[model samples]
Target: MILDFGDGFFLRQATVADHAALAMICLKTGDAGKDATGREDDPDLLGLVYTIPYQVLEPDLAFIVDGPAGACGYLLGAADTNSFNARLVSQWYPDLEARVADPGPDSSRWRGSDWLRHKIHHPDFAVPQALAAYPSHGHIDLLPQARGKGIGRQAMAFLEQRLAASGSTGLCLEVMPQNVHALNFYRTAGFKVLQDVGLPNRCIYVAKQLGFAPGVAG
Candidate 1:
């Protein structure tokens, strides 16, 4: 176990066996930090797209959040966003594209998991120039059972330390503008808003400098 949060909650390194649990957590908390089960037809798509790749390609930074009830959340990171995205495009997306059909560009006809299917076909790996300074990127999600107990804060700190230890100078996360709670949480944790006009309408990037000094261990 990586951390023991008490009350039967803890953090651990994620394994291939934990993929299903990670996907479930992603689906449950997929809708702007709320349950999105009702909106998804194929429950695994969200996890397949967002969570599993981290475990497969960047295993060192992938972690699971566990509670008394079993796996309830995850914390995933890529130490270098550009390289990670490149790997995804070259190594990951092709197999995924074959497994799922594109829902086409007609947004009006897309429903449930169709939007995710479309994303699979036309994957966007663009890194805005504004985010270039913060090359590391991360994702975190928790089920209701794991929320409101300081797990998120601790999990983030753990990720930050791991990144800094690996010589990363900064970390950034893309959040939905509507997720006010997440925005507030990140702000409280020392992240600052990065205004990037090139980002998609649904995205707001918040970043923190890792403050690692040369020749010093994080």
Candidate 2:
């Protein structure tokens, strides 16, 4: 599944073996301004989890970017609300619970934990409307070298095709509103702003119908 992007970059479906490297990318690129899961707070550990049995529990929607020995980027997803997000919560909750066991008022982990709890209890958790067809989209990241080469777009297009096969209407994800480039990228990709679901900061939720080709010019 390695896609030669020319100029030494490659795209491939990640495997259980690639978890550590992929996690490093996630850790290095996490939205430090806001890590809702508290998972991204530590990149190395996150990488370890990705390569382990955690993914064996859910495999259809995870991938990585490889360049050299280290992983440059990754894209992980879930198809249905019950399968993807649920497995994510099930896998991470205990660690979160442990971290918050005695988190004082000064603890960001405490706040993050509370936020996680709130979202899980929220109606969206009950039935994330976004999951209806496009219910399973998520973050995609690349190393600095990989930007603007259409790797992100290719990864997205790959995901959209997967969604379409599943009968999904579209794919959805959030981006920092201030990141003008990303906003424009999605718009060009035919994704419209669904809403602003930013919590700590203003990250807008955007979505695109699944069937359109990524050939659209923004």
Candidate 3:
């Protein structure tokens, strides 16, 4: 199913060729659901950590929303969280560890590239309960220009179908408590709060089963 935007948008499987453009979109919408063109100097921080690796490891699982201008949004992640996280730290993190610059002493209040760099060294996960119950996860980012186009919902539904087909029983994701819009979207998408988390970061862990109620849509 092609989830198009306006009259000219369409969806396609993300390829290596789209890496740079996808990373740019990740940066453009990195600031808590807003445009952050000047928010950080490094455009690869978020994508390198959260996005690029997923595409690199599981190319077919990644998809992009394309428009006349360029890539406007994308859904990138793995089907199995436990395995994906293990591979990420053991295999993927090592590659990024050498390149990601260290965060300063006051990195606690940092955002954008600085905070992203910090996270590279200190990987975070959802709460234990959530992790045990929902073993698949990923993230989605849509540029401001892509919002209100129903692309988010379409992208999510497509992702759910893909995940369910992959044999994932459930999916999970970590969201910052402050992103109210995201929280609402997840709720509408059939995700429920699994629990509150405060380990590596203060956030709420949300989840959805794959084949039933409180589940990802068809």
How much lDDT does each candidate structure score? Answer: 0.92, 0.59, 0.76
Which candidate would rank higher by lDDT, 1 or 2? 1
Look at candidate 1 and tell me the lDDT of residue 79: 98
For every model shown, what is its TM-score relative to the native structure?
A: 0.95, 0.70, 0.85
Q: After superposition, how far is residue 65 of candidate 1 from its true place, in Å?
A: 0.7
- lDDT by residue for model 3 over 1-218, one digit each (tens)? 35654667778888888888777887787777666668887877667776777778888788888877788888876887777778888888887879977786596667667777777778764336535556678788887767877888888888888898888877777787878999999999888876445334566777787865354343
**What lDDT does candidate 1 reach at residue 70?**
99
lDDT of 2 by residue, 42-151 (tens): 34543443333235555666777766554676766656646655665667545544543333434355543343343323313344443344555666777776778888
Model 1 weakest 10-residue run by lDDT: 209-218
Better of 2 and 3 by TM-score: 3
Error of 2 at 204 (Å): 1.1
Question: Can you tell me which runs of candidate 1 are displaced by over 4 Å?
Answer: 212-218
Which candidate's lDDT is highest? 1
Point out the higher-scoring one by lDDT: 2 or 3.
3
Which model scores highest in TM-score?
1
Tens-place lDDT per residue, model 1, 1-218, is 98998899999999999999989999999999998999999999999999999999999999999999999989999999999999999989999999999889999999999999999999888888877668899999999889899999999999999998888888999899999999999999999988767766778899998965455322
Query: What is candidate 2's CA lDDT for residue 39?
Result: 45
